[model samples]
Target: MSERNYRAAIIGTGAIAHAHARALQDAAGRVSLVAVADVDAGRAGEFAAGYGRARAYGSAEELLRAEELDFVHLCTPPRLHAPLAVTCLEAGVTALVEKPPTLSLAEFDTLIEAERRTGAYVATVLQHRFGPGAVRLRRLQEAGELGRTLLATCATQWYRDEAYYAVPWRGTWESEGGGPTMGHGIHQFDLLLSVLGPWSEITAVAGRQARSVETEDVSMALVTFENGALAAVVNSVVSPRQTSELRFDCERGTVEVEHLYGYTDDDWTVTPAPGHEDVQALWVKDRSEESSGHASWLAAVLDALDQGQAPPVTTADARRTMEFIAALYASAFTGERVRSGQITADSPFAQRMDGTGARWRNA
Candidate 1:
């Protein structure tokens, strides 16, 4: 481990920033929470006072200009993620941004370019991928212990009532990105992509089933992985009984996890086929206690920084997840199957998740 103790700041004093503060606190000796920024000065001051010695700034620009930070946790809105990250990158500070890192694929690409221009990095917080259960599952899959992955299902069925959308940025395409697919389900499906690898194609449908929002509250997609595995994905904010679940059926056995939000190893189950009973031992061996959340992910990010390597959830890796979201939207809107890499920089989908405008926008 490097001898240097990193100094960090949080750029948005929202609910999510509390998670970042806790994670930074968990890394007490290794990383310090130095400052926090928010458009609302009073809110920022209150948050800063609660998080130890962190100073408060009225704006991200003020924080960046005054504080010398190793990295900034960008818990800002979707639209601010890219620009704020770019600002951090330009300042030679790494940025750890929350989910729906950017409002558009084009914005994400800008981050990639900014990273190249500056040696600093941008890491998206897709915390689900860092959970111990997910780590073990990925290890087994990579070792071919999971056998040929045959079929899978990933769902993020969570309830978000009308009151929840009262937060101005909660459901709009421009500010929040695409509804459940981008905001809520992106976490579950991102874990799905991390485990299953690159996707080959996507055909999807999205609808405004409930809530009067500028975006679809529900979406469903059929995804084909490069490994020839087919999966069904459902993202919805209208479910009465909320749950995030993923099941993978392979030649050897099936691995499943059912939980809401974050999960620990207990949330996972591994069943070996009749002749593959030995696989159960592999699943339980060297299990991790870390749950899927900001703390676990923050640990990994710090590890990367210490080694002078790019952090977990690197922009390239996140780009794949973002591209998948883009393609899902493209397919849902155009009524056509969208292939991986099909949403080129020229594609409108790259400019915004809604692309040429969501069908519901005109309706």
Candidate 2:
């Protein structure tokens, strides 16, 4: 259990698989990439070749059966995440699943069930929260430098060229689970929810404005937080410059964070309330090196495994983020406000998310 060295496996050999590999390497003495598995033997072999002394498997089942892994990094598409993750946990391997844990609420529930049954620690990779800018923002909030937060807004406008969605499962509801909202927006929303707790209700609309995908390439949502703070989220794959930004309006000041997915500089200002000159003295310049977000989170996963504890981001916590998306879809289609608590196992929308529908036809 010493942090000096630990063994880990990666479940998928896709693009994100390389990111996980880098994270393992980044941890250096603390952890090592022990093995890798992919549905395609060629890809698995290629991945194994890049990392030093890694065993390769043609599939996850084979890898799990043959090797002892301290943790598994799952980089498969959204739909395949649950079953594979459960398999790892049930087999006594810890896991760090990529963003947007699963395709639907039901799948997320199964992940939780598997965790309960096995006591395997499963963490969701919402790496944005690890950014230095975000850390600074949290410190400010904790110190009450921002005062009462009234509203927050996040926008992710990034281009996904035709070739980007050319892959069979790229833009589909069945595999990838919708468009940028689930793919790109999930990261920003993760940070939002991390700072501001669970939302009370959400109303949203999604449409296919540009892409050939069955699901919407553009989506918008209006959220009412449990703390009564208002929020708006917009995600699109049609924009040109690829802008990621967040703005907060608070009683004493305003803070704006720029750069959609990477490290960013947070610009903030303070306006003291009347007769509060002494409080103004607390303000200080906030600046720090941006984080290689996902790498930082993966390091935490390794540390957690070494200590026999749960990572900061857990499967149950991720389920709520998925519920936020499900509730948004329900409200959009029904033309009624949707409460997060209303999306239980017995909810009407629960059965319809079969991971396949007209929404995936174009994708």
Candidate 3:
């Protein structure tokens, strides 16, 4: 809110925190990383040393009280997101949280309320939607170049071995939320929802077929968008050959992107109708060279700071994605179709997503 480099801090010194640091570093003149905090002071110190000017803290409370940060990145696990973000908002600082922003829709609503109470804002890390290809596709779809969407697919098929699940939070519903659906597949599906807009209905089935986790390791859903397009969504951790894919079958042609974690212009391909080779030209023109990643999204966040507005993946957008996660679980466990906005504050699925509750156990 001042005429200075926007002060920032990272709350967790974990795997994703490294990306946040690199992204902040890349935005050198636009922002500064003033502090780093973690349960392990050594890890925080190590992260601070890597960034030069950053101070290290043993806890987020220390970082918040000591530093006058404009924003903080909640890179901690899923469960800590709402608490950390609420803490930042209460301290008059904006927050940029990592994906699967909260454990459930109820927690997410708490965040929405916090942002309302505080003037500060919150943005979730959905880097895929910031890519040039995604931007181009959304523009193309809007301009009627893609024509009416008929069907689509969003698949996040990633391989996580037994050792990976050994992490206490990896497979648990309370810690990491849901498995591939909430943790891994969220990116592609968020991007899918971005392209398709509001979803009306979802019918899904989730199963703990392979993983020893308390939640579903694999799930599939049929989604009906408000635009009249239909989609088949799949989330899985058991696939040996991992890939992140989203394909849209539209009236003009098919737009597809295939990648693992992130996407570049190279990963996006447009298969236009027989006489529509020029469609690809229109799609590729005026495209940003950077791929879909934290750096790009961070730039957008910093830019929004200059403009005095909440960044992309705001609560409303994040809620749609989070609501879909709820709907996925609600439909998967319950043998009924779930509509948007069904998982309210009073619902058991909104409170906690494990299969031990009424709607879940009845399935």
Candidate 4:
């Protein structure tokens, strides 16, 4: 694999599909969006036509059966992630999939095994970690400028109307996973886990407070991290306005980051200890590339593939995040503390979500 163009396929022509297409086009020389797939042929055709050099397929199965792709990016609903990813891997293709890899831990484990057997590069789209602000915050924490981060939490308040959940398979426990927690909260939660390391336990409660969906619209969780740091997470689809932020209260200083998704000029506020002014100087060095989410992860994947190495965000990482969600759901339903690593293949929550009796708002 010299400097030859890296051919790619995109499975799912939904809203997020365009983001993948644009990023692939941006990596023109190194990567090319060679094909597009969707259950809706019209959608796939339209997507392919809009983005140059793409052939369209009616379904993911059709694409996998016909195309010889170097890599495939899956923008399907969360429920389809596991099967589609495993299909791609079995066909000897790597998958760059959207977050909350599957509906349950059992599915995640099966996919992990598929990756092991097939040696596929399965990576999730947790691109927020690529932002300069996040990188800088990580560096500062490493340097002890923000010493002993004891408590952390994230807030994501975004609105999604009935029309939003009207799409088939949008708000079911079987389809989109579990609404805000798996679909919306996943991005920021991944960022949180990235910065704070692994969590030790979680207790949560979720309910369908607003829109009509099969899953919960509002949820809250209390987490204990491996480092003994406490965290609270609140996510909802009921807010009129959107706000996404992460705050880390540390020993020496408190660092706050505010954004709906990515970096902004007023992205961060760092308060250092009495003599830690030098920490701010570290931001002066220029990074060669911009820190936008999707593009950065694509760049990393292409580079890693070129170097014959694994992707930065691997299936194992996806498992951890999935476990986090599982634990939260388990705690919420059982009224018991759930261990982070306990949501394995054998965990009861692995097969069915606890909200079996309850139906999503729209579903």
Candidate 5:
């Protein structure tokens, strides 16, 4: 690890920014939060004051011009993610963007191009992948200890009242992206992909359901991975019995985690097949205690920077998750199974999650 300390800043002082602030605090000696920016200058000032010595700026442009930073955490709304990340990349600063990294794959591709041009990286914050249990599971799966992943189920079912969508950006296709599938469940399903490897195709359905919003309040999909592992995915913001859960039934055993938002080692349970009880020892061997959240994820990001390598949740990795999302929307709206790499630059879905407007919106 590099001995030199790194300086970072945050753009947008929202509820999520507090999580980023805590992560920076967790990194105390390694990374410092030097600045913060927001359209609401007062909010920015208050956030900076609460955090530490970070100076406040009225806008991201002002911060980028005035501060020399190693990177910036973008906690802005979904629509601003791509542009802010691109601005950071152009400024030769890495961007650690919150999830649904971009509103669309096309926007994410632009960031990828900017990285190629500027040699600055943009990493998405899919923190679940860094959790101790998730990390251990991936390690085991890669070592072929879990055996072949046969079937999996991933779901993010949480309730959001009508007041939740009252926020200007909350339920819109143009701002927050595609309801729960993009904003909420992406974390769980992204972790699923990290463990299962590349996905091959998706058949899905979405409905406006009960929410009086422009986007679907519920969506479900059948996913096929390249390794022949199948997964059933469900994303919803309308369920009263709230939970985020993922279960993988492997050839050797079953591994599962159930939690809302974040998880720790305790949230995971591993069951070995009748004769494969020995693998249980391997599961607990050398397991990390770190929980899934911004802190652990940021630690990995700093480590990558220390070694002069691109950070975790790289654009390519993020793209897979993003592509799956796009494919879900395509499948849901078009009523057809969508394959991986099927939505090209020419595809409307590439330009926007809803493509040519959602069917419900048209109706």
Candidate 6:
């Protein structure tokens, strides 16, 4: 990495933009915030002024055209991620986009095409993978400390009021893609995918039980991993009491994390079985302390760029996560066990999440 600061810019000054700005600020002397943009001119100007002495633009196109940046952090809605990242790649600038990188596999392929043609890298913001807690678990499992992963569970149950969905792109298929699974639970589920690696098949169900929206408000799936491990996954936006949790039952014992949005060391707990108490000591020995969030992900992305390597959560890895999402929706709506590769480019589910485009037409 160069001793001199690498220039960085931010697009979209929404809630997530603030987190990106703070991460940049937290990065201190490593990266310099060069510019920021939003459709709302005032928001862009304010974000730039508050974060750094960055120039502000009214749109991402303007931001890209005017700056010579090393990378751009895309904090936009799900619908715009593909095109915006494609624009960045085409301009020879790398892109770090938020999770559920695109609406569908077909859409993600467009970004892949642009990347191959442009020679610029595109990384998805699956921040949970970069966290210390999960990192520790991955290392232990690889060393045969945790033994084989036997059973795992991920649940993202949170509440959203009417006003929350009132935003133009809240819970629509055309805009935000899918509901809890795509938008909310994505962080936790992506973390699950990282731990288990590739998935094989899924049988799932989804429904729009409470929210008056176009997509499912809740979903449940049984995922089979390549290593012969099984998982039960649930995503919900209508729960009254919200919690984000993941539990891994390995050959030694069980390792779990319980938190709402983000987590720290306190939220993680490891239990060793009767004969494998050493697993608990190894877990407490040494690992990163930084909680998973925008800052940690940004650090990894910046470090990768400095080393002239592709950053974390590359498109191909992110595809597996997105494919799992598509398969779940396909299985839920079509009443079939959707295999990992079943949602292909020609699959109707790949075009639109509903497959048959029946449910939530008016949601």
Instruction: State TM-scores per candidate.
Output: 0.98, 0.90, 0.96, 0.92, 0.98, 0.97
Model 2 lDDT, full chain set: 0.78
For model 2 the local lDDT of residue 136 reads 68
Candidate 6's C-alpha lDDT?
A: 0.89
Q: Name model 2 segments beyond 4 Å from true.
A: 1-4, 264-286, 352-363
Model 5: lowest-lDDT 10 consecutive positions: 282-291
Candidate 3 stretches with Cα past 4 Å from truth are 1-4, 355-363
lDDT of 2 by residue, 1-363 (tens): 573677889988998888889878887898888899989989998999999999999999999999977888899887788788899999998878887687778878888888899988788888887776677667777787767678999898889888988888888767876678778888888788877777999988777788877677888899999878899999899999888777777677666667755764434344555665543455445455447367878766766766778885887678778888777777766667989788777875564432323343444
Candidate 1 C-alpha lDDT tens digits along 169-228? 889987998899999999999999999899999999999987899999999999999999
Model 4: residues with Cα > 4 Å off, grouped in runs: 284-289, 355-363
Model 6: residue 320 alpha-carbon error in angstroms: 0.5
For candidate 5, list the clashing residue pairs, or say none. Answer: none
lDDT accuracy of residue 346 in candidate 2:
83
Per-candidate count of clashing residue pairs (backbone under 3 Å) = 0, 1, 0, 8, 0, 2
* lDDT against the true structure, each candidate: 0.93, 0.78, 0.88, 0.82, 0.93, 0.89
**lDDT tens string, model 4, 65-169?**
887789999998787888899999999999888877788778878888898899887888888877777777788778866778898889888889999888988
Compute the lDDT of residue 126 as modeled in candidate 6: 84
Better of 4 and 5 by lDDT: 5
lDDT (C-alpha) at residue 22 in model 5 = 99
lDDT of 5 by residue, 43-90 (tens): 999999999889999999999999999999999999999999999999
- Candidate 6 regions exceeding 4 Å error are 358-363
TM-score of 6: 0.97
Model 6 clashing-pair count: 2
